[model samples]
Target: MKKVTSDTEQQSLFWLIKTNSGRLSEADIQNFKIWLKASDDNHKAFRKASLLWRTLAYAPTLSEQPKLLEPEKKLRKKRQINSWYAVAASLVICMFITLMPELEQPTAPSEAEIVSTLELRTAKDEIRQFTLLDGSKVWLGAGSRLLVKLGSSSRHTQLLIGEAMFDINPNPQLPFYVQAGDADIKVLGTIFEVQKRNSGILVKVAKGKVRVAAQNQYRYLEMNESIHFEKNKVLPLPSKINPESFAQWRSKRFHFVNTQLKDVLHKLNRYYKSIIYIDDPSLGDIPITAAFQLNQLEQLLNSLSSIHNFSWHKDVYGNIHIKTNESEISF
Candidate 1:
């Protein structure tokens, strides 16, 4: 804490931590690996600054907004807009977001820096909850990011990239919103989850309703309903059921219903912090209508192997890749 790194270097480091950390590109990771090894103090510096930054950022949240995220995402959400507002207000009393004295954000030097714009980012192992000006709650999945543009009359939250959960207080006049990739989830008041997957944007609604519309066509899902919107086409909800089991991943239970093996594996990689590979393209398409606890990785593998005599290989770093005659490997 006594040594001072240049402000520019600090900004770059924060940006990198927020935007790339766990999701670093192969080349970038290699570069980071080299850099980390170049100095003994780098790791210590990053750990300290990152913790301070996260702790300090919460001051605005606790003093400013409401707590709306569901515990374990096991929220018992409401359908009517009024009910949603009521629930959101109650969570604010819980006050999960608090500031530590160590983190005092750099005071804005100019009016240009004092705008209502939000530049949000998360690091490799960081999990943060942000309270917005409109009493909306956001949980920044690790290695994810988003930015917001606020105006006098409107509240706009944009997912520049990555995954997030929103428990919004419906201000019909203000119109709470989120944009992921090219698609946007808009509602006056509702709760939803959005992820930027390799295949498309995964959008799921927990409470009230969400409108997944692109082009001229639109699809609306009532409570516990969701869908995937990609390439301007809104497909039937990815599966025919509520994917809440997958929603509250921090709880350590991974849920999927008729989800393909490959897709399920991807969820594991994302939440469990494991690297997984499927042997064949077809393997990903195989249906896995099951619920798994992350701690039960062996149990999951055993169950899978019984399904197809698949051989699973795990490395020293907790990464598991499957390869075998029964298993056609694809990462």
Candidate 2:
């Protein structure tokens, strides 16, 4: 196979996103495989494209937008929609390549251990669902980033930040794995949710058993069981949480049972994108028992404050600052 030109590399990226957009038919998957095998350069180009895609996917989570970093000339051209926006440049080229079979056979899927990663990301107020090639399903909460790497014999996912629920297809020969914060979970076939937080990682199993390992400690959890880990320490024993109730986030509903205020806010921030800060450090340790409906953030805040005696005010920048009533003063 010949080296892929920069133009071809861009085209490979175009197809990578296109094929993964959940609209691909069975025939499309087959055609994509055929096109991929047409050249070794195609694989190399797709890998490069995947890296760039992942980086751009993560860009939205940062506080500052990336537009300021571009050169003045390029920035102006961006407004014209031909220079930086020329990702479409490769569309026609790849369409034409799909018709050509002049190259060698692509790497064999069963024998080859492909280690490329594709990322899925959600914006501040967005939730998303992703279906992997192996029929595994993922539901990602807002502001979440998940990287999936499917090998020849195993399926794996890494949660870079935020939360996700996995509905994995049963494949004994190829077990599924997830890396969340400091912990790693392995399951053969199961429904599970993993949440990563500043304090630690939490794993909840909905169906089959999951093996969680962190800091040289290993624990197994069954259906209706949940565990939290902070470094090497696992919370006393697996707690019972109704799997269905725990997955209510799928419908934008939330349930917190004696959960810490900071942890609850951590989950809410993933969905709302609002910067919430506790002006009183003692408020961080407050335990919260609450249920919330999506898009009802104001009501949720008001209800929590009614009992907790903390007043929250929104700043001009849309950030919410919560301080106890004692700390509140006239503006």
Task: Please tell me which predicted candidate would have the highest TM-score against the true structure.
Answer: 2
Candidate 2 residue 254 Cα shift, in angstroms, is 2.0
Query: Per-residue CA lDDT of candidate 1, range 76-186, in tens?
Result: 222233354445533432222221111112122244433388788876545678888767888877667898765555566678656788888777656566777766566
For all candidates in order, the CA lDDT equals: 0.59, 0.71
Stretches of candidate 2 above 4 Å error? 1-112, 316-318, 328-331
Instruction: Output the number of the lDDT-best candidate.
Output: 2
**What is the TM-score (0 to 1) of candidate 1?**
0.55
Q: Tell me the tens digit of each residue's lDDT in model 2 across 1-331.
A: 5544453454475466666577775545654665467679878888876765554333222233355555775555545454333444445335435543222122222436755569999988788899988888999988889988888767777899988999998887666788887777887447889988776888888887887765433456788998876864533346788656766776879887788888888778777766888888889888988777867878888988898878989887788898999895433
Q: What's the TM for model 2?
A: 0.60
Alpha carbon lDDT of residue 204, candidate 1? Answer: 74
> Which residue pairs collide, candidate 1?
170-188, 170-189, 278-329, 278-330, 279-328, 279-329, 279-330, 280-328, 280-329
